[model samples]
Each structure stands twice: as structure tokens, then as C-alpha cells.
Target: MTVRRPAHEPAEPLEERLRKLEKINRALMGRVERSTDFSGNGFSLFQTAIVLEGQVSARTSDLKRTLEDLSDAYARLEDARDDAEEAKQNLTSAIEAVSEGFALFNDAEELVMCNTPFRALLPDIETRLAPGTPFPRIAEFFSQSRHLVLDQHRSPEAWRAARIDLFRKPHAAFIQKLSQDRWIQVSNKKTDTGATVVFQTDITDIVRAERLRRERELDEQSKILQATLDHLPQGICMFASDLRLKAWNHRFIDLLSLPLRLVTPLASFERIWEWAGKSVFVHDGAGVAAVSGWLRAPSADLDSIELGKSDGSILSVSGNVMPDGGIVVSFADVTEERRASAALREAKETLEQRVEERTAELTREVIERRAIEVELIKARDTAEELTKSKTRFLAAASHDVLQPLNAARIFLSLLGGTGLDLRQQHFAGKVDKAFGSVEEVLGTLLDISRYDSGSVEANIVPLSVAEILTTLAAEFQPLADQKQLRLRCMPSGLYGLSDARLLRQIIQNLVSNAVRYTTRGGVLVGARRRGGMISVEVWDTGPGIPADKRDFIFEEFRRLNQDVPDTPKGAGLGLAIVRRIARLLDHPIAVRSVIGRGSCFSIELPLCAPPRRVEHKASAERLPVDLASFTAIVIENDLAILEGMMELLQERGMRAIPAVSIGEALETLQSLEKTPDLIIADYHLDQGTGTDAIAAIRRAAGHAIPAIAVTADQTAKVQAEIRKDHIAYLRKPIKTGDLFALIRKVIAE
Candidate 1:
């Protein structure tokens, strides 16, 4: 390697040293000539030669040292050259291994070096793209490859011009879509030395993914728009700016009454209009021109036209201009609306005449209605008065008729206990039973009337099923025995939400019906839980009620034709009363039966929490343990009822005192030996209530004493008033056993 010295080393170098040596040799030769000329002596020549030899030896040594310096400088230059070559190879390898196509361009806009990937772009011109290749030439070769896609640049010259324009910018980047659907992100950036570096990264996957996503979104939106159009009430058809039908819903065809042949791929507004026979849009040729003008102009304001068909129907066509210069036309069939409007107009024209006629007719009707209403009011008052009379009669019978009935019942009880013959006793029993039947029928009729009048309200309360069933079992035991049919009362711990009296009456009627119908097998009355309700069912093995007759059996005075004549028939109002009571209590009553098998009558009652413990009412069969000592003050308005009650009490071994009114009861209590054990008074007395009598007698007696308010008036008001004074209540005609049991219960307390 040849080494050149650095400029800063020295102004004079090895050449300067050699030129000085030549000058020294010239001066020595001149000295030798001078010596030879001056003395022509060999000694001078010998001295000069010795000096010259010493100088030569010194100069040679200097030259040897200068040569050694040049060798060392050459070795350093070789090392630097080797390092630069290694660095060039490393840079080449780095750019070659890069994932992106990398190219370096010189300041002269010439390609200096490029990676293999960049060369791959111009595969056919790979060898031509040597170092220092002009950038324009390389770009020209690349543009000819046809792999790059250009935006707004279909021609090759335009794409190349765009690329050159971007290259001139300080820094630029653009996405290049290639043939075969490939993509490249090309970034052109400048280096510090005014050279440009370009990087092209493949983004085919990203571009494809984004495009696919957009296409899917557009497809979904198109489907949604089509669906929306299909569901629109008005018919719709959209036309492109070219007037070709782009989309249409089925309603458009239906409204236009057009044939399917006109709806082919070549369908257009002109074709349909031409086929429309010119009657739909023609208005002396002026309407046609106006419609044609608007249809041709994509930017026209919204317009609408109404058309009439030959069939006397009407169609309203409205057009809207979309942002895309397309038109959406809607067709509305307004035949009914147009006809109705015409009718309304015609009606309006004659409205005054009609109004006058209607007014006069209304006036006449008003007069007639007024007369009819007056008569209706009179009839209503009469009906209401009749209802009131019936209610009053029921109330009157409760006090007057039931008063005698109570007295009669007690007298019959006394008569039955006497020493009468068997035949006399049987007749007495029949008469007594006749009285009972009369009482039952009258009571049932009164109840039915009250229910019909909507006057009976149930007193809803939680009642123990076991207690009610037990009492009913004992009461019906004799009747069951007489009929030779088994009666079973299943004990239940369930409680039911119902009116106690109404509930008992419902059950009693059911049991009676069961016993009356059954000639053989037993009757079972029990309660069972049904979901949240308790069903009290009466199951009897008898000739079952026919499915057809079951509904009618509950009607008034309806009875099955009895085969056994011995089975005493009732008025058949028991089930009727049951139905009314069940309705009053809002309990659901139902019956299921099979022919020749049996019948089950069931009533569903809501289940309720257990009622609070209350003092049990007296058992009708029970009496006071020390009956003789138990004295009762009896107050009654009716003398007959008073006498009978006194006799009954005395018969039960109680000392009885009597009063006809509150004053009499107070006076009787004042004269009593011991404050009466119990005070029993009629609810409706001459001048006061049973509560008033009991209160007066108790005040006169100077202590709180047990009392009972007895009444044949079974009205709720009477019962509530009697119970308000904390007195036991008994309704008439009272059973003898109930009276005794009440007396026993009162005295024990």
C-alpha cells in the first residue's frame, strides 16, 4: 500500500529530503573542482573525499529512517482499508435481512444501494438495478412491473409522476395496492447526507381484513334497509340517477296493479309509466310535462301527485331525492280515504237538515223517554217498596212468627217428655216435624229474598273445621241412624276463611242433601288442603246426580224423582240456599258425580291463620252441674214465648224469674234473692232492646253478671248489637238442647 502523509504533518516531506540530498551532492562536486583548480594536489582531493564520505554515511542513515517511517504508514493504511471493507459488508447484510424492502438513494437522485427485497420488485430488471442506477430509471422499471396500484392514476405516466412528486418531498408515506390484491406501505425518508431511504412493508393481510369487514358491514346494512322497505305500509320503489329501478318492495307492484313481466332487470320508471295507459298522470299533457321535469332532475325538491285509476280507486305518489341523486317514490292507495272524504263533504252539505230532523226526533224521543222514565221510576219505587215489604215481613216474622214458633217448639218438647202413648207421641212428633219444616222453608225463603236483594253480607272470619264438623256430626247422627246410612265426619286441623254461620249452613245443606239422596252407603264430610285453599267435601254413595241435572238440582224446588217413597223429600231449597251462602262468602262451590256410583259436593275456602282462642259456645246437650242453684232472669216481650222459656228453664232445674220489658227486668232483678246467675232477654222488647234490659238488670243487681240475648230477629244488626254488650246470643226458634247447653255454659262461667 502507498501512504500519503497528512497535510498537518509538515510542509516539507520525503521528496523535500531527497531534493536536499541532491543539492548537497551538487555542492560537493563544485568543491572538488575548486580544489583541483587551486593546487592541482591529490591531498585536497583526499580531504574532500573523506568529508564527502562522512556526509554520505549520515545522509544514508537519515534515508533509512525515512524509509522505515513510510513502511509503517503503509501498514496503518492497509488496516484502515480492511476495516472499511468489513463495515461495508455488515451494512449490506443488515439491509438484506430486513423484512421491508429498503433502498438508499444518493443526492443526485440515483439509487446507491438497495436490499434484495427492493431488487425483487423489478425481478426482470434485477441485474439492471446496479449501484448508482438513476432513481427515475428504477422507478420507471418498477412502474412498468404493473404490481403497484395507484389511486386516481390509471395511466403509467400518472403513477410515475405521483411517485416522483412524493419523492421530492422532505418525507412521505403512502399505501400502494398491488396487482393480485397485494398491499405495500411505502415510506420515503431522507438521511443526514441529503440521501433518501425508502421502506416498503407488505400490508396485504391488514388491507384485506379491513376491506372484508367493510364489505360485510355494507352487506348487513343493505339487508336491513331492504327489510325496512319491505315492512313499510306504503309501497316504495327507488330508482338510480339513470332512471333504472334499483330496488322496489312488493307493495309498489300491488298498489300500481302492474304485471310481473314489467318488473324484470330492465324495469324502469319510463317503462311502468308507458304501460300505465297515460290515464294515471295525464292532465291535459301539462301534468305529464311537470312530472317528467321533476323526475329528470335529481336535485329537485320533494313532490307528490295523486292518480285515479279506471276502477275508481285513488293512488298518491310521493317522491323524495336522496343524497346519492337517487329518487325514492312511495305509492299510497287512498281509495277508501278519498271516498270517505267525498262522503263527509256530501254529509256536511246536508248536515243542517239532518241536524234539524235528528233534533226534532230527539225532542220527541226525549218526551217519550221522560214519560217512560216517570213510569219506570214509579215501577221502580213500587218494586223497591215491595222488596222493603218483603224484608219487613221477614223481620216481622223473625220476631212475631218465630216468637210463637219458639214457644211452640218448647211446648212440643215438654209434651214429648210427658207420659203419652206411642201413637199420640207419633202424631205429636209429626206435628212437631211439620212446624220445623215450616220454619225451615220460611227461613230459606227469607234468606233467598235477602240474597236476591243483595242485602246479605258474610261476616268473614277464620273458623276451625274440626269444631264445626264435630257439632254437625252430633246433630245429624239421629237422622243418619233413621235413614240407616252411615255418616262419617272426618276430623281436620285445618282452618278456613269464611263466614261462620254461612259456612255452617253451606255444610249443613250439603250433608242434608247427601243424606236425602243416599239410600245405601255412608256420607263422608271432611276438609283437605288444595294448594293454598281448604276444600270441605261431602262424599255420599248414592244414586249420583246426572250430569245434565246437576246444574238444575241447585235451582228452586227442583228435586230428583225419588225411588224410595219413605225417603222424606224437602222443598229442595237447601242447595239453593247453599249456593247463595257460598256466593256471599266468596267460596267456590262445585260438585262432581258419576251415574250409579256416588256424588261429591265440594266447596273451596281460602286457608287462614288459626283464629285466636275464644271461649267455646255451649254444647246444646250440656247443662249446669248444679242446675237447681242456677237461677236465670228471663225478659221477653211476648207473654207466650216468655212462659214457654220459663217453663223450659224450670224444667232444666233452674230458678227462673221473668220480665216483659227492661223496666220489668230491672224490677225483677231488684227483688231477686241472689243476683240471677244469668239474664236472658229478647232482643226486641216492648220499649227497649235485650241489651238495654240486660244492662238495666245488671246495674240493678249491682254486679257484672252473665247474660244471654235471645232473638228470633236473625238480622246482623240485632246480632251485632246483642254481642256488643258482651252477651251470648241465641237465634230463635231456639232448640231445647241448645237452650239447656247455653244455660249450662253461662252458669258454669
Candidate 2:
């Protein structure tokens, strides 16, 4: 590059201009002298001298100003040169300070500058990396250098061609692995000045760490696979694609009896198999090619080949090709299994003869068979009492476990009746409600067990529909009233044929359940005649049952709220019993319900002539006697039960007293204002028998006094004893409906 002066500045040096100007002045003076001597005219010479002198002085002044301008321009040019040199030093220092090897190339692709690392990385070409060297030359040196880790599969020519092709790209980054196992990341970036900068970063540590992790993982996997193969029960051997043995467990050697030298690593599978010995099929026309053939070209199917030895041993051989083209073969001894199968076949062929011999003894079995069957029938009939495996563990559960259970319920019920604070009543109500649930579960279980054993007999008979319904209403009205629900019953003079006892129980259960679940509206019981049938429907305004669950509701242990997580109260057996009873009576029951409205259960009964029996239980003349008005003596061997019954009766406004045993009965009677209206005594009392105590109490009162014997033991012996005394018998739980009806009936008689 050349430096040119500005247009207004002098082209020549000030000293040179001064020298030329002085020389011209001297020439003019010489000319003046010559004119003076040659022309011989002093006047002309004098004029020439003045003019020459004046001109010389003006020329001198102009030279001085020209020199000053040149001096200022030279000073500014020097400062500019210094600043350019400083900038160059700063750029050089900055590039050297960078960690990565830096090299800059001009737009012509020629090397402009480079840091120490750039040439340091390529020691072989260090001398060649100069300012004049082109970018392609450096790339060629890098590709051909001994340090370059070239691909073994690729020709050096191809790798070089690709590397050079990428040199001119605007932005490029690639990884270059050195022969020394170092990793370098190289990036080529274009500068705004139409230059390119290459950066090479060493990532040896990171790459080595990653490779180590991968190697460790592969090693662990190898160890795990070997361990699993060694522990396998079957003899196993794995071969590489080349059909050379890669792995084999000791079992393979022992099972096949192969030579140890033939089963070593890199041993040919063909040689190993040959030494393992030839296996021929026990059955003709069943054979397979050598496993080595499958190793060469395996199919997806993995069926096994069976081979038998001369010693009556059979082997099952199976093989599969691995994902990496390796093949694994397994051998299993199935000798025992094969023999057992053959024996089973032989037995089946000869089984008819044994059956014939057994059948021939039929004549002799007649007497003994009847005797065995008779014993089985008797055992099943009294299964609950004798076996203790049915009927809620047979009647024992009802007596032992439920004795305290009944007492708890009674006490809880009595507590709810007391005028405690709101919170106390709420808690007591929940406790009582829980006890009721337990009773329902136990009762339902007992009912299910009895039904299963065919112990519950359905006694079908003629019954008055109106009287039955009136009795049901009277029994459940108090329960409904407690919940502030209305119980509506439409009296029907028309009667239908049904079991009086069971029909009452069915309607009674329906009304009782309706009162229990109904939180609003009421339960409506009405009857309508449809042609030759009477439909006795019970409707309840409660959480309606789903249509899907309508049939399921009658299933034992099934509830209407099965879809929700919350388990609703009730053992889900009420409707189940209803279904069973309806079937027994030849009555078809139907149910219709809406999601939020209510449910109606209708029992279709065949229409029949009115019954001849007259029922005056609901007559207006007889005052509605709820057990609340009467007084009774509660004789229970269990103190808790005695207290619970006394509290329960008194809470309902009855003048009741407690008697723990037979001895307490006399004391309780002597304390009563009037010979207690009724006697409620447990059969298994503390001392002397409860029936004996009841007889004594009756003798003291001078009349029967409406005696009722309550007992946890429902055995035939206990019931017979209570009945022989002419007293009433109720089960352990003492169902309120049955108890109340029995009490009223016994009192009236």
C-alpha cells in the first residue's frame, strides 16, 4: 500500500523547494549582471535588479507557508499510523488469550492470522501455516496428518474430499477424534468483515467419561446375563453368528456328556454337537436337521424338538435367534413327564373294567347306601346345631356373640330416648344406628344360611289383605313418626291367598324398611286389582334405586348404592328375602324407580275369594296399645342385658324393672305397684332355669301375667321347655315386631 499527499498540501519537500527557489534567484541575478555589462546601460540594469530582488523575496515567503502546512499534515499522519499499530497489538493479544485454537481467514480463503494453539494442534504443518497459506491447504494438512483419526471403513481420499467441501461453508461445526484418543470440537464461523474464524475446543475428558460409562454398563449386562444363564434349570449354550460357542453353562456339558475341550470359547457348535452324540427319534418319521442349520437362518417359530435315548430318557430341545443374530439352545429332560402321560393313557384304556366291578356290587349297596344317605340327610337337617358350620355358625353365634350385642343395642336405643342435649342425642343415635346395622348383618347371614340349607319352610295359606296391611301400619307407624315421615296405607276389603305368617312378615319388612330409609315424603302401601290379579305395591320416597340395580338389589349382600363408595346402612338382604318369599308364594314382584323421585315395589298376587277369617286387630274399639303403656319384669342372666331392657322399657313410658337372675324376679315383683303387666325373662338365667323362674313369678302374681320367655339359645330343647310351660318364646335378638305382637296377643288372651 502507498500513501498519497492531499490535494492542498505540497507535493515536494519544503527544503527541496527552498533550494530550487534560491537557484532561480541566483540565475536572475546572473542575468542582470550580464545585461548590465553587455547593454552598457546603467539605468536598465538598475531596474532589472529591483524587480529581481522583489520577486525573490515574494517567492521566499510563499515557500515558508507551504512548509508549515506540510509539517501539520505529516504530524497527523504519524498519529494515525501509531493508532493502527496499537489496534493490531490488542487484536493479537485478545486472540492469544482465548482457550480455543483461533485462526482467521480472509474472504479469499487465505490465512490472515492465527493463535499459537492453531499451529500447536497441527505440529506437522506448523511451518506451513502462514499468512499467505490458503484455507484448503490447512484442511488438506489436517486430513492427511498422522494425528487425524480417520474412519477405518472410509478411504482417506473420500474423507479428505468431504473435509475440504465443508471448509467454505458460512457456519460449520464437527467433532474430530485424534489418533491419541483425544476429542476436539471444531467450529468455523464467518465474520462481518467477510472473514472466517475457526475454533477448536478439546473435549477429551467428557468424551472419555461417557465412553467409560457405556463400557461399564455393557460389562454389567454381560455379568447379569451370564449369572442368569448359569442359574437356569435347563442346559443352555449360546453361539455367535459364526456358529462359534460364546457362552455355555456347566449343565450343558454334564447333560449332553460332551468333551470339555469341545465346549470351550470359540469352539465350533458343529464340532460340539457331534461330540455331544447323535440323538435318534424314538418314533419313526419325526426328525429335524442339526441346530447349526437354524443358526444360519432362523425362523420366527420356536417349537421344540423331542429326542429319546436308548435308556428310555427323553429330551426337549428348543432354540431361538437373539436380536443380535446369535442363537441360544436349551435342552430339558422330560423323561418322567413323558412316562406319566403314557401311563395316564394306559389307565384310561383300562378304566372301564374297574368301573364294571364297582357297579356289580350295587345289590349289596342298597341297604348300606340308604343308611349312609339317611345319616347325611340327618346331618344336614341339624347342621346348625350339630355341625356348627351353618346358620351364622349355627345357633351358637346367636346365643354367645349376640347376647352382649343385643344388650348394647337396647342400651343405645334407650340412651337415644333420654332427653339428653342435642349433641349427646346425636351421638347416641349414631351408636344405636350402628348397632342396628350389626344386627341386620347377623340376621341376614342367618337367613341366608337357613335358606341355603332348605331349613326355612314357606307355609302358604289364605290371608286377609286389609287386616294384614292394618297390622303392618300399626307396627311401623311409630318408626315412621320418629323420622317425621307419613305412612299411608289404603285398606283393601278384597283378600288374596298367601301364607298368613310369611305374608305378614313380608309386608312388615317392607313397611319397616320404607320407614327406615325414607327421609321425606312417606311410604304408600296400596292394592289394586288387575283383571284376575291383585298388585300389592309399596312405594317409598327415598334415594331411588338404579334401573340396572333393580334385579341386583334382591341378590344376597347386594345394596342399591353399590356404585358409590359409601356403604349404605342395611345388610342388603331385606329385598333378597322378599324375592325368595315371593317365589315361594308363586307371586311375581316388579320394581319401578326414577333416579331422584322414588321406588315402588309391587307384588303380583293371583286374585282369589275373600278369606273367611275376620281380623279385629286394628278395630277402633281396642285402644292402640303400643308397648309404652304396659309394665314388665326383665329377667336376664347378663347384668348389661337386664339394665338395657329395663332402660328401654322405662324410656318408652313403661313401669318396667330389672332382674339379673331368677332371684331378682321376686324382688322386682314385690316392688311393682300392680302385679307387673308382663314377664320378659331370659331362658338361660343366672341361677335356677329362667322357665322355672317364670313359673314362680306367675304363681306369685296368681295369674299368667302375660309371660314371655326371651332366650339367646334357640335350640329345640330350650323352645320345647318354654312351650311346655305355656309361655311365649322369642329368639335372642328379640325382634321388636314379633315381641310386641306376641306380648299384645298373650296379654289379650
Candidate 3:
């Protein structure tokens, strides 16, 4: 069955349908008027209907293409929407990945988004922190939950107002602390859309490090202060505001002699005061009060106090005030300086008293001495005149006395040498011994005179001690043997600056005394080296002197009793002469003795370097065999001495000429057929001295004749005169052997 279409629904083109309908209507009207023209009109209407159907087909194809293009555009729009959603998911993931809390706020100050860390920052209010939550509400939740740890004194309203105010202002970084004492640094940045991005960083480690650095600095400062206090010389102690010992140095303990156990930081000042009062400041009554007062008002400055102790020590104590109600004290010891000042004051007083007494005594002595001085001067003049007379008498008497003695000695010697019976020889020896004693007494008198007159001048030279020892040994050996005593002289190589003649005399007297006193054992003569001097000591096993007599022995004419029967007694002038000679030579003498053992006598002589070598005449000890061929001239003022000298020379087998004066000697030489080999002259001549007579004869003969001066003048002036003439000098009553030796030595030369 075919459905009928509604009239409003047109299935074909309107223009073509409208044209067909119009043609059919026009033909119906015309046929009614003229039915014969209907076939031609129907054909024109059919062509118009065909054109309308073609146009309707083209329009339907164009509408179908437009519908397909609209479907493709809708599919592209769906793809772009999916890509935008994926980009938003990536941005949210990156924000959540950060370790710090991060959040974003919109322009209206509402919470738009936040990471999990931001939510964790406020865990109690994390549920309230969501998108579209206002910042003021979040701040209120943080305050209620105590999440931000804001000021405890501030109200919640104020805290919320402050947070809102900070949020609305231009974004900046600031710090926040949590209620758990963790630190957070908040940094905010404003976006282009007027939202804020906040980053919170935990900074607890940095805060702890800063705190530790401050602590270390404080510790260093404390150490430096302690070191400075310890090095101070003065004892130091510091008390704190609580009136307790806060610090002290080791010196403080040492200075006060405090117990170590009682001293420590925060120790009570009262306890220290009690200990100091009992020990160090035993006598000071103010010590306890001072400590109490210092502790009570530690900021008050105090003056230094000088406190004394029972043990004779003094302490200077001073205190200073600290700004923080504390006290610093120092101590100094001042004992020695105070004592020294007192001693000096006492000495000054004593010295002044002594000076006053001495001055008074001197004033009295000056008055008394004036009266006695006049008498002393008169006595001294009289004594001097007597001494001069004594000297002249001895000089005059020596020649007269010695002239006969010398002749007797020569005759006795000559008679002994001749043929004689034993009895006659014994008689001659006895007489010779008597003459020897007389000669000794006279010689001693002469030596004492020379010393008293100061005529024995010292001719100091460098002489070997060995040489003097050798001579002494040879001279004393016979004496020692006669007494059955050993005499020894130890070899010495030391030299001294001394007068050889005076030294020999001093040693001879000592040795002679030794030999005289000793009857057994030996005498030892030796030298020892002392600093810058040589000690020539004579040790003898003699009848040792008694202690009481030791000092008296050196006095003139003081003798000890002789114990040995066969030992000869001395005139006691030996040691007396020794004392005088030692004094003249400026040498010190010492004597040590034991009653039964022996004695040692030592003389100190200055040590000297050996002198330059000089040609010295060899010592003559014996007559030569050529004595008989020598000729001699004798000049003497005394007839007996002249004959004695002539006979002694002739007996020794030599030609001898006797002349009483220089004129006689000159005449005797002119009458001689040859020049005399030697001249022997007397120093005290009627014409001139022996030296003058010899000079006259030497001039007449036109040559320097080898001469000998025989003089009774023992004065140094006469001896020096003879020596100045280069002639040998012989003392009065000369020994026969010595004269012969001198004659032989001179002629041989």
C-alpha cells in the first residue's frame, strides 16, 4: 500500500512543482474555451518539470558534505581538552616531591593548593587546610592547635591579625618556630596572578651550631682570665657577690701558708678567715673583721693594711672592688726590708757614740804627749852621742887588739907546722883554741857594731839556694862529724832575690847553733817552695828548746842550760844575730820545736827568676904548687901586722916586700928588678888607704897590678872602696889558709 504525504512536506523542488501546476491550471481554463489546443501545452509543461528535479539533486549533495566536516572538528576539540588535564597533573606531582613545605595562595588570600609537607607542618589542622580555605581561617587553626608557637602573652585574635597582616603585605622571607622547638625558614614569592608561593626550610642544625660557637667563645675567655691571674707575683683571691671564694691562684695559698684542702671555688670566706687567724695572721686582731666586712660590702674599696705576725713576718694586704659586687685582694711580704732599716738605724747610733769617746781620748793624749816629747828628744841626743863614741872606740881598739892576736895566731900556726914533740904540739893546739875564742868574741862585736851602725847594706841579687846549701854542708860536715852527728843538705834548685852575704850569715848562725846544741841524730838543711817565695828551713835533732825559752833564745845573751857534756856552749849570740840579719833582709823567721825531739828554723825569701849569666871568679880553696915563683908586696900601717903578713907569705914559699905607706911601696917597687906579682896593702895607711897605695904603685909601674887590701876597717864604705878598685879585700886577723888561697888565686890569674 502507498502512504500518502502531508501537504506541508514537499518531496520535489518548489520552483519546478509550482511551474507544472501553473501550466495544468492554465490548460483547463483554455480547453473549456477551446478544447482543440491541449497536446502542445502538455509537452512544454513536462520540460519545465525535468529542470526542477536536476537542481534539487545538486543542493542535496552540498548539504551532506557540510555535515561530515562538522563531525571531524568536534573530535579535535576533545583531544586538546585531554592534554591540558595531563599537564595540570604533572605540575601537582612536582610540588609534592619537594622536602620543604610549599603552598600557594590566591589573590583573595585563600589556600588554593599545598603539598603534603605543608599539611604536615600543621598536622592537627591538616584537614582544614584545603583548597579555597581562607588564610585567616588557617592562621586561626594554627593558633588554636599551638602549631606556630607564637608569643604566649599575645591573644589568638592579635596573632591571627598579625599573620593576616603579614600575608597581605608584599611577599618576603621570614622565620617561624614550631611548638616542638624545631626551626623553619619561610620564603615567599608573588606570582603574576597576584598569588603567593611560600617555601619553608628546616634550620635547626644552623641554630645549634651558632649556640655552640657562643659557648666556646665564652670558655676561651674564661681560660685567658685564669692564666693572667696565675702568672701574677702577688697572691690574688677573688670573692663573688655571694661572699664566697670564686677564684684564687697557687701563689695565694703559698703566701698565706693556707691548708690546700680548705681552698676551692665557692669556699666560704669565714672559714678562710678562721684558718688565717690561727696560722698566718696570728697576731692581727683586724683580720677576721676585715674578711667579714669585705664579704658584707664587697663593692667598697679598701686601703692597704700592714699586718704583722708573731713569727716576725709582715704582710701588706690591699683590696679592690669589682663592678658586680665582688672583691679582689692581694698580699705582699715585706719583712726583710723592715729589719734592714732597723739594723741600719742601730748601727748609726753606735758609730756616733764610738766617735765621741775616741775624740775625747785623743784630746787628753795630745796634751800629755807634749810634755814627754821634750825629755825624749834630749835622751835621744845623748844616746846618739854615746853610740858614736862606742863605734869610734871599737874601731880604734880592733886594730890594736887584733894586731897582736893576729901575730900570735901566725906564730902558733908556723910553730905547729915545724918539727915538734907530741907534748909541744898539744900545747900549741891549746893556745890556738884560746886564740880562736878571742877572735870569735871580737868578730861578733864587729858584726853587732856594723848592724847597729846600719853599715851592712844588702846587695840583693838572684842567688841559687843550692849554692848556699852546698857551701853550708861542706863547712858543717866536719863539725857534725866531730860531735858524732850526721849533717845533711838536701839539694835545692830554687832561686831567690836576696843578699848572698847576709843570707849566708843568717844560715851560718842558725847552723852553728844547731850543731852546738845537737849531740845525736842529724841536721837537715833544705828549701821548700812557697807561693811567690822559697822557705829555707834548717831542721836539727838538737836538745830542743823549752817553750818558755824559745822566745828568749833570740834575745841577745840569753842561753839555755847545756845537757850534752861534750857539746860546746855558745855565747848565745847565734840566734840573736840570725834575728837581726833576717830583719835586715826583710825575711820572716819561724821556729818550731819539741822538748825532746828537735827544732826547725825556717826563713822565707822572695822567689825570683835566675839572672843572666856572668863570668865569676872560681872559688879558691888551696895554695897552688907555683906559689914559690910569685912575688908579693905588703903595705901595712901597723908594724906587727906588716911583719906577720910578710912572714906568712915567705913561709908559704913566696918573696915578700913590706911597705908602711904608698911612698915606701913606690920606692920598694922602683928598687925591684922586676914588677911584683901581687900587692898586699893595709886599708888604714899613714899616707892613704890601701886602695890609694895600690893605685900609686900601679901608676908607677904603668900597669894594673893585682892587689889585695888587708883592712881592720869592717865598715861597708872601706870594703866598697876596695871592691871599686877591682882589688880583693880581706878582713882583719885574716885566716892563714884563706890568705894563701887568695894569693895563689890572684898570682895564677
Task: Kindly give the number of clashing pairs for every candidate.
Answer: 0, 0, 0
Candidate 2's residue-wise lDDT over 1-749, tens digit each? 12344544432453465456567656665665554433547777788677767765765666555455556546545555666678789999999998889999998989999999877886877888889688777777777788788767876677777866776788888878886788888898888988888998888997787666545533543454455456555899888878888888888876776777677889987677654445333242243354445556764324577766546678788776554457778888888667756755565454545446667687655665566567555644654353335443544445665665666555555544544434345655555564565566666665555555455565556567888888788888887887788898997977777777767767776776677666788999988898988888899997787878888778765655433422234555788888777776778888888877888888877678865655666644554577677888888878767776776666567777777877678987787778888888887765777788889999888887778888766544667789987888887676555766777787776
40-82 per-residue lDDT for model 3 (tens digits):
5767657645654554454445434433433333333344455
Write out the backbone clash pairs for model 1.
Answer: none
Query: Which 10 successive residues of model 3 have the least lDDT summed?
Result: 1-10
Per-candidate TM equals 0.47, 0.40, 0.49
Q: Name every residue pair that clashes in candidate 2.
A: none
The stretch of ten residues in a row with the least summed lDDT in candidate 2 is 279-288
> What order do you get sorting by TM-score, best first?
3, 1, 2
Best by TM-score: 3
lDDT of each: 0.75, 0.70, 0.75
Residue 429 in candidate 2 has what lDDT? 58
Q: How would you encode candidate 1's per-residue C-alpha lDDT over 171-244 as one tens digit per residue? A: 99987777778878889988888999999888889777766654563354345445546655589888888888
> Could you tell me the TM-score of candidate 2?
0.40
